[model samples]
Target: MLTRLKDSTPKTLLLGGAALFSVFPLLSMLSAALQPQGSSPAGFSIPTNPQWHNFVDAWDVANITTLMKSSIILVVGVVPVAVLIASMAAYAIAQLRIPFGKVFFLLLLLGLTLPYEIVVVPLYYEMQSLGLLNTRLGLILPLIGLNMPFAVFWMRTHFMSVPAELSESSAIDGAGPWQAFRRIQLPLAIPAIASLAVLMFLSTWNQFLLAIVLIDDPNKRTMAGALQGFVGAHSTDVVLLNAGALLIMAPTILVFLAFQRYFIQAMLAGAVKG
Candidate 1:
């Protein structure tokens, strides 16, 4: 009992510390959001009377409905395209045994190293030349491009982990390559795909920099960009700001929670292999 208690004590402390660290900012934000407008100094304690309606008020004033629509548009457009393209590319790289497959894999992996910030200027010019500026397609195209590299790399690893015998068995049964991939390989990869989809959804949903640079109109801008417009040089509305922050975080949190099991399984699958 003494030995077990000693071993668990440090872990308990660490978990407690982590929980506190993670929850503190959120608690502070909630308190701020519930506070009445003009009731307290910035960064101060909770208001005597908390105003839950501030969330509704902020939603209206910020025109969050339109912002939510824009965010949804970007996410819905990018996630499916990114996943399908990445899955296909990964399948080809992992299963095709094509000539120069290693080279192609390396090139795809190299995309993981390239940061979006480094290419934003050139990307802007390219979009401008393509007559895509200030358009929804313009914003979504760049996000998809930026997300593809990592998506391809991650999905490739997952595809490569699939048993070789499964594909070979399907081939021996006279199934075509596409049939083998579609029927045999894809079903086994659902967990990894779910994990990738969740990650891609979160990244695209939370994207700020690309939205800010690519979209000029407020209506076209994403939640992150819209949130920035809430604060100004002269005055900052803490309650509404926190309310917006909370609203912005809700969809991503719900998505993660819904798919968290797949994410855990994928991570375990990757770890168990190596």
Candidate 2:
């Protein structure tokens, strides 16, 4: 027991150190946010009197209420449709063995290789011609398309991990592929779908370059895009900037914390099956 404890001590210390390293920045940011709006906060400085109202003030200054609404709209518009399309496509590739499956999947893999910046110029031209530029729909469609490669890839992995016997059993019970998908596979895949949805939400929420380029209306921009303007306007006010940054980040953090259990389960499910 002593020998085992000694052996584990190094690993425990390493993990503890890594966790502190990861959390230190967040702690510093929180400390900064608690300081007075115009005050410059040092990393180790605790406020003499914590100003919780900085978050409230920052929200107004950053137009965070509208920014949050816009972000929520974008997330909702993109995540469900993207996850659905990816799931259906993944089902086809992983379960149905669709014709030329290898070729089709390879094309998606090619998308993963191509950076968004490389594609954004041509994409802008296309949206401009369609008169879709500067609209939420413009962001939605492209985001769904952009997210497909990863969403499909992730779902396909989960579907691959699912047992073939479930489909066979459904077929024996007189269910068609579509029926089986609705009644059997989708429910079983809830964890995976939820996981994909969370990832898509994070991606869409933080999508800055695309939102800035494709959408011109500041009011219609995602939270990250608005943050650019917010930061520029408040460049000199470090405390307020940190407070606003935390406000922008809060939703994703809350969402992940809320669904972290399912997220962890989904992550482990694939590995357990494999």
Candidate 3:
């Protein structure tokens, strides 16, 4: 009993500390947001009256409804195309016995090492040349391209874990390659695909820098870009800013919570198999 108690104490402390660390920032933000305007040296104070109405004011000021629509359009456009392209490419890399497949896969892996900062200039110019600059397509194409490397590599790893015998068995039973992949491989890959989709959605939704650079029109701006504008416009309004921040975070938090089970399962599958 003494040995077990001693072992558990340190773990309990560690977990307590981690929980506090994780929640502190959120608590601070909420406290600041609830604080009344012009009440303290820091320009905020603990509200005698907690202004929940500040959220509505922030939504109106930030034009969150329009920004949200733009964000949705970009996310919806990018996620499906990126996943489909990545899955097909990954499947090819994993299953196709093509010459130079390993070399091509290695090149794809190299893409993970290339940061967006390094390629943004070239990408901007490419968009300009293609007459897509400042358009939704401009914002979307770059995100899809940038996300592809990691997506393909992750999906390829998952695909490789699937038993080759299953494919062969399907072939012997008169299934064509496409049918085999669709009927056999796809079902087994749902977890990995779900994981990839959720991750990609989060990344695409929160993207700020690319949206700022590629989109010049305010109306075309995504939620992240719109949030930056909110900060600029309300530098002194702590309540409004925090409210906007919370609203911006809502979709992502909800998405994670909704699909958390699948995310956990997929990550475990990849980790265990890899």
Task: Give me the candidate number with maximum TM-score.
Answer: 2
Q: 1-274, model 2: which lDDT tens digit per residue? A: 9999999999999999998998788889989999987778877677889999988888888888888899989998999999999999999999888899878889998899988999899999999999999999999999999999989898898888888999999999999999988898899899999888888898999999999999989889889875787788999899888888888888888888888888888988977876
Q: How many residue pairs in model 3 have overlapping backbones?
A: 1
C-alpha local distance difference test of each model: 0.84, 0.89, 0.84
Candidate 2 backbone collisions, by pair = none
After TM-score superposition, the amount by which residue 126's alpha carbon in candidate 2 deviates from its true location, in angstroms, is: 1.0
Q: Judging by lDDT against the true structure, name the best candidate.
A: 2
Supply candidate 2's per-residue lDDT for 233. 90
For candidate 3, what is the TM-score? 0.91
Model 3: lDDT equals 0.84
- Worst 10-residue lDDT window for candidate 1 reads 226-235
lDDT (Cα, tens digit) per residue for candidate 3, span 1-274: 9999999999999999998988777666676666665433243345577877777888888999999999899999999999989988888889865688899889888999998889889988999999998899999989998999899988898888888898889989999888988888888888788888999999988988888888889778788876888889988776778878988988998998888888777778867876
Displacement of residue 102 (Cα, Å) in model 1 is: 1.9
* True-vs-predicted CA distance for residue 127, candidate 2, Å: 0.9
Query: Is 1 or 2 the stronger prediction by TM-score?
Result: 2
